[model samples]
Each structure stands twice: as structure tokens, then as C-alpha cells.
Target: MLTLYVDAAREPNTGLSAAGAVLIHQKAQQQFKSPVFQSLDNHAAEFQGLIWALEQLTDHQDILTVYSDSKLLIEALHKHYAKHYQDQVDRILFLLASHRLVFSQWLPEKDNLGAHNLALQALKNRQTND
Candidate 1:
């Protein structure tokens, strides 16, 4: 079974945000860190990260179980709705449509350390450069 873990981080003072994701299947693994060029909130960053992660798997044709610590992202995917983030939610849905099966599940923050750290590093790198 293929599993994905994703997270996003925002520098509160600067509103610098980025997305991180990890995909794993047995021995194969991939990590991603995408900077959200636009200054978005953490919730929005999560969606951007998800979209980036899904884009990397456009050729993948199997069940994918995704885990994230953002409740907004998980719930939006489950119900297919979001108020302020409706566009992001819609984009995520569009991305999912290409996959055979994808489950957006939630986990505790501590459990999503891989993606969390990636997101933090991404944000830090962006903040440092720009």
C-alpha cells in the first residue's frame, strides 16, 4: 500500500509558507518541499502542498492513502467543501480525480514529523532567501 504524509508551515511573523510531503511504498520513497510563493496561511499552504504532492504522482495508478495534520485540509477533502479555501479545495479535488483511489486522513501533529520538518525547512529557506 502506498502511503503519503503531508504538512505545511508558516512563519507567523512573515507569513512565509511552504508545503511538505512524503510518499512511501515498501522500499520506494519520495520527499517534497514546495514553497508557496504567495503569502498564505498555514491552512492554505497545506492545500498547496497537497497539490504539489499529488502532481508528483500523476503517473501513479493505485490506491494512495494520504495523512496530514491539518484538519482543514482533511475535512475539506472528505466533504469536498471549504469556505475561505474553496478554490484550494477544488484544486485538490481536481488533482485527486486523476488518481484511482486516494484517501485524505488526519493524524496528530507529532505523528507527521517528516512532512512537518520539511515544511519548516522550506519556509526557512524561502525566508532566508527572500
Candidate 2:
């Protein structure tokens, strides 16, 4: 089984946002993180992070569980309802249904430390590269 934790952040006064995700396969004790530029709202970024994480999975047959701190995103996914960002929402939902993915809500930033730090580091790296 593979479990993933995801988070996203948007810079204040800037449209720029980044999404980050960390996947841990407990049985194998392996982990991975991905941080990418997301030219969208925080909600979109969160959903995108989940999608990105799912895309990284090596085995589609593995039991997949996704964790995120965004309640809105969790609720949306749980309800199978579409949000304003129809494209992103549709994409994520399609992936979830296709893979038979499981969704869970995680609160308290401490629990999502790795993904959060990766996102901030990605922002720093982007700035440095520019």
C-alpha cells in the first residue's frame, strides 16, 4: 500500500503558488516528494498536488491513500462534487476513480511537514534560478 501526503502554498500578493506531495510506501519503507509550480489558486494547487502524487505511483494496482490538509479539497473529493475549477477537479476525480484511490484529511501542519517544506524550498529554488 502507498500513502501520500500533500500540501500547497501561495505567495502573498502574488498569483504564484506551488504544490507539493510526499508519498510513503510503508511496507517498503520508501518515500518520495514532488514540488511543482502551479499557476492557479490554492485549491487548484492542492488538487493538482494530489494528481501529481498519484501519477508518480509505480503500480496502479497498489492500494493508494492520499492525505491532504485542505478540508475543502477533501470534502470535494469525498463528495465527488465538482468545484469551480472544473478542469482540475475533473482530472483529479478521473484519476481517483480510475485507480480506485482512497482519500483522507490530515490537519495540523506538523503532520505534513515534508511536503510543506518541499514546497517552500521549491519556491526558493525557483527564485534563485531566476
The number of the candidate with the highest TM-score is 1
Clashes found in each candidate (C-alpha, N, C closer than 3 A): 0, 0
- Tens-digit per-residue lDDT, 51-98, candidate 1: 888887745777789899989889999999999999888988887786
lDDT of each: 0.83, 0.70
Residue lDDT tens for model 2, 7-87:
876665565566666777765544444554655577777777777766767767667777778887777777777557667
Worst ten in a row by lDDT for model 1 = 35-44
Superposing all C-alpha atoms, what RMSD in Å does each candidate have to the true structure? 1.5, 2.2
After superposing candidate 2, which stretches have Cα over 4 Å from the reference?
27-35
Any residue pairs clashing in model 1, and if so which?
none
TM-score against native, each model = 0.90, 0.83
In model 2, what is the error at residue 99, expressed in angstroms?
3.0
- lDDT (C-alpha) at residue 120 in model 1: 86
